[model samples]
Target: MTSENLIKYTQLFINNEFVDSVNKKTFPTLNPASGQKIADVAEAEKEDVNKAVDAAKAAFSRNSEWRKLDASARGRLINKLADLLERDITQLAKLETLDNGKPVGDSEFDIQCSIDTLRYYAGYSDKIHGNTIPADGDCISLTRKEPVGVVGQIIPWNYPIMMLAWKWGPALAAGCTMVLKPAEQTPLTALAVAALAREAGFPKGVINVVPGFGPTAGVPLALHNDVNKIAFTGSTEVGKQIMAYSGQSNLKRVSLELGGKSPLVIFNDANLDEAVEIAHGAIFNNHGQNCCAGSRTFVQSGIYDAFVKKAVEKATNRKVGDPFGDGVQQGPQIDKASLDKILRLVESGKREGAKLETGGAQIGNNGYFVQPTVFSNVTDDMTIAKEEIFGPVQCILKFETLGEVIERANNTQYGLASGIITKDINTALVFAQSVQAGSVWVNCYDYITPQTPFGGYKMSGIGREMGAESLEGYLETKTISIKMPGKL
Candidate 1:
């Protein structure tokens, strides 16, 4: 399953089958570690988008088998899909690594997590409930949850397979037909998963994938009047554009898990080993491309110098090489634009007076690789501390008190996730309660589960992604009242 042995062609998935793009246009998905195209994916045009949307709409409308099926039946179908995914994890992981330049180990974990997520949501399918209300008269009142209809889901390139599972799981469990659009950089795994889904007995047109550029296909999907909802996981800037399109076209319900500049605060009383381990896991995991990654780290002033030194040493020791290697811990960014963006942000940090601790330069000549970078003496106002670099770069800032660190951590345009490393229960409780971020980790960072609800606050995006609450996003609440013959 290595890139050398991997195949190069993948067709679009529409109407529960592999189909060619209407225009027969194709785009090469490059391996960021080697700067070489590993696969060619169908480039979905506007007509392809229309076909996918039409398929999803038909599946969602009345008389369609997908919408006619009960939640339990949907859950069984998705669980079958999860089983198929588990059987092919190895091959799928290799494809993801080759297509996205993430290490094979990380890709395996991501694919496994994707399976768990689908199963988790599938188990919750029948758990979606409605409530009855008491009335003053001899009347009945109740509320029910109904599917939001056709959903246009867009997944990011960093963790394509996992994010797709995150969106598709709940959307499908809620009985909403979906039109998925994976990032153009890496679409092989998504297409492969769609094939497995078809084999799992999902009805035709229940799930469709259209792969194309953002402007042409993505924008059209977001602007389609028939699309009942838009769910996106990407940058904040692009999230804004999608929101605008949703507003202008259909005013559809939109759920976004956008960009994050999450903070990891280490108190003086924290466990040094645990702090260091969690700090590394927070930013270095997935090459720091995670939206909920604790990218902005703040340490107590008393332990600032020692913490920065140890963190830099640990970060610099990260293995950056071929993503296909088994022991490689870090790999290249997703593409050339991502690499250039990380480099430019590093330059901005240097120009703005942050001290480069270690590993700031680019690595290798053939790929879009960046050395694991760490910056010290980063104030809260610096660009490195404020903006998300989204590479394996850590910005270590110093803080004095718990109150001060909480305030500084909350002072950001993004509120996706934050972490606290401290042994004191009172301090951890206060910080967790006071932090504005959606998720707060106590001694761990970048921990995700299909049971825990994941999302953000303020500019970080809207709605929740996991847990029972996620089912709500795909459903609309309707109130029903019935009058009795006799008055109260």
Candidate 2:
């Protein structure tokens, strides 16, 4: 698909209507692959955020059609949205590839994942239930699960539609009205999906999308007193700031899926060929912009040299070009700032004495493209080894024993995911139990499904994203106790 064929939706979606920002401000959303302007998007500031919050609050009120509808009806509406998403997956994927600079194939995968996530949550809309307790002394007691009044969601540029699904699915399934702030860099897909939500017959003010920068739209959403909850997927620093904002305001419930420097360990007994492929895809997928990318790869000393050679070969052979081009496995970074950050981190890796195996430089002149970089002989103290580079840079660290590798892997403050490639079941089980990460992939990497809960340990933020656990974040529990007179 060409840029001319792609559709642009630039207005803020509020109360089921596309409208200009209150201040009439706008910003240019760029095509990161060519450093060109894609469209002029509406820029939402604090005033716009307030408007969205008010809309959501009105939709969540008792008298509103959204709150008065049956839970099954709500589920049907969500399912209709999912159906619409599946029908328009092609256009949505192209828009995502154009706006976010991810490969078209990867964008398709993201769209499919989003569709699956929405369907999964739609199945649970009416099934969200509380407990009924058998009480004593003729008193009946029960618990009810009710929706949190209004939610504010802020999503990242990478996997924009998928993250929107992750946050929106549970919130909608739990019957919460929400105002979403899509990342300023890539708001096209979110705006498009908001239109789909409206088409699927969602009530006015039940869903809203506000596209703007973090400091303006995001901060106001988090700090809004009327918003009962906030869900965010982004950097650990920004996640922390949102948590503080929540506390300083109404102590709104906050759920965050933050950064990671996840470790992928390969043992000597593993299948060498399979391990090499998994490790390469784990670190280099989506140009390694994934928060759960296995950036720190720990290989056994017995096969470290061979693994490094094979990894370098794979990185050197991978295609990096336009996201829309055929057979392009790697694409440009999201923007110039992200491109500069990745380059700086790669330079730090070289200066800190990590051996650059094969690729380590920028690729093109006009856009933000980086070479698939591999650093061998990397120590734990190196800047690249310790930081979440969020780029297609791999740091291979050699380990002598299982115990040592586990210790080294758990040393990082952020623990989102880990992977172990080993033939021995005993070793896999031991490592899985000991790792501090939220998800441990045995003989696999990045195998996420809608049924599985995704989150992290330590500073990797709070709460889960996908699965049934996510629905709980958007719901509140109320217990009712009744006293009955039996023989009076």
Candidate 3:
């Protein structure tokens, strides 16, 4: 196929145009579905990162046309960008599919979500209000919400496009210039997004993208003194490192959406068919690479066997092949390293005495794919139950009562998202209120809207994204209190 025919792959986008890297270092982004090299992307070094940051800093400091534009003008620009995205949805979706190993249709849906997010945040820009404090004397006092200047946004490989929206939608609407570092594995869509923004008349240096490995580009961006705020979506380990760098370097404001071993609980009262389908989606969608994959399932023992049997049967029937191929439900891991980590976790589950019910081996020859493994009788202590596999692996554990299940689910170090499937309204309400997760899905999994705030609790993450609160995270609150000289 010609390069144009391939939906994914781009060189680089920096400062409102496609550009070449200064280092002349290039890396191949692979199609995970077939383990085939898709396209060569310019590898950005620390100097390149510095350049991007400097450009963003300059843009933010200049009070340029971008800043001078009124809130309505900013909103219009974002809406126009959204319109451009919708106009070329297919191309963007195809690029996401090829690079991220997700189905094209799903990629399109993600693009739609991105569009909605931008529009939502755009509407919020003018509405973000300052609070006027009632002063004791004849002084004017108010708090204003202003952008934190230059932002360094680093997105993870899984759901790269969506995560980018989560970071940039609010940051952009808040009038912060941003330097984006997309995960090396999935830079194609990000590059496309940068192009769209430029086409929509965003000023040069308002947004820049540099695709490179995390340790080099990501690290420097987080630690750069010029970067006033850092927003990241990735593992907790990396989140910690970002925090450490931010503390040591600039004391920058940091927002992270980290890893999760989110739990899905199905009570005996749940409609079996509905529960089973949502359960599969919770765990297996995106090949189970979801940060909130619902990896740990707590099913009521009254219907545990039936649930597990149906879950395995459905997963086994799922088509696992090339992501670009029609009807394929699952794709390969992002790379070999992720595949190996998943396999080791599966083995650890077996060693820990969890019953390996079905599917636990590499499936294909060319790509880093694993079978849709399911484990039953999983204890809370099992590695599969604790650590994030970031693959298509499901571990189901039985619980007798709500108390027991809730306890087991919250016993983890991470609390990103949790799901409950119960026909009883009271039960659903209880679980929703009591669960320690950031989001509790009832009767569904992976359902997200642009207006709702999403993030995590505890080690799962810090700060919120995807809602008006996200704008707050990108801004600084300052209180101006003027003392009254004559009244007191």
Candidate 1 residue pairs in clash (backbone atoms < 3 Å): none
Among the numbered candidates, top TM-score falls to 2
User: How high is the lDDT of residue 36 in model 1?
Assistant: 81
TM-score of 2: 0.99
Model 3 weakest 10-residue run by lDDT: 1-10
| Clash counts for the predictions, in order | 0, 0, 0
Each model's TM-score, in the order given?
A: 0.97, 0.99, 0.96
Name the lDDT value of residue 395 in candidate 1.
90
For all candidates in order, the CA lDDT equals 0.89, 0.93, 0.86
For candidate 1, write residues 356-474 as lDDT tens digits: 99988889789888899999989888888888888988998888898888888999999999889988999999999999999999988877799999999999999999888888889
Q: Candidate 3's residue-wise lDDT over 1-488, tens digit each?
A: 12376443365666776777887889998887778888889998799888898888878875687778888888888898889889988878877887877777778888899889888988877887799998776788999888899999999888877888888889888989999999999988888888889889998889999999988889889999999999999999999999999999989999999999999999998889888899988999888888888899899999999999998898788888777778878777788888889889889988999988788899878888889888999988877888899888889999998888888889999999999998899988988998999999998997879878889999999999887778888888889988668845
User: In candidate 3, which residue pairs clash?
Assistant: none
Task: Report the lDDT of model 1 for residue 134.
Answer: 96
- Who wins the lDDT comparison? 2
Score residue 233 of candidate 3 by CA lDDT.
92
Deviation in Å, model 1, residue 325 alpha carbon: 1.5
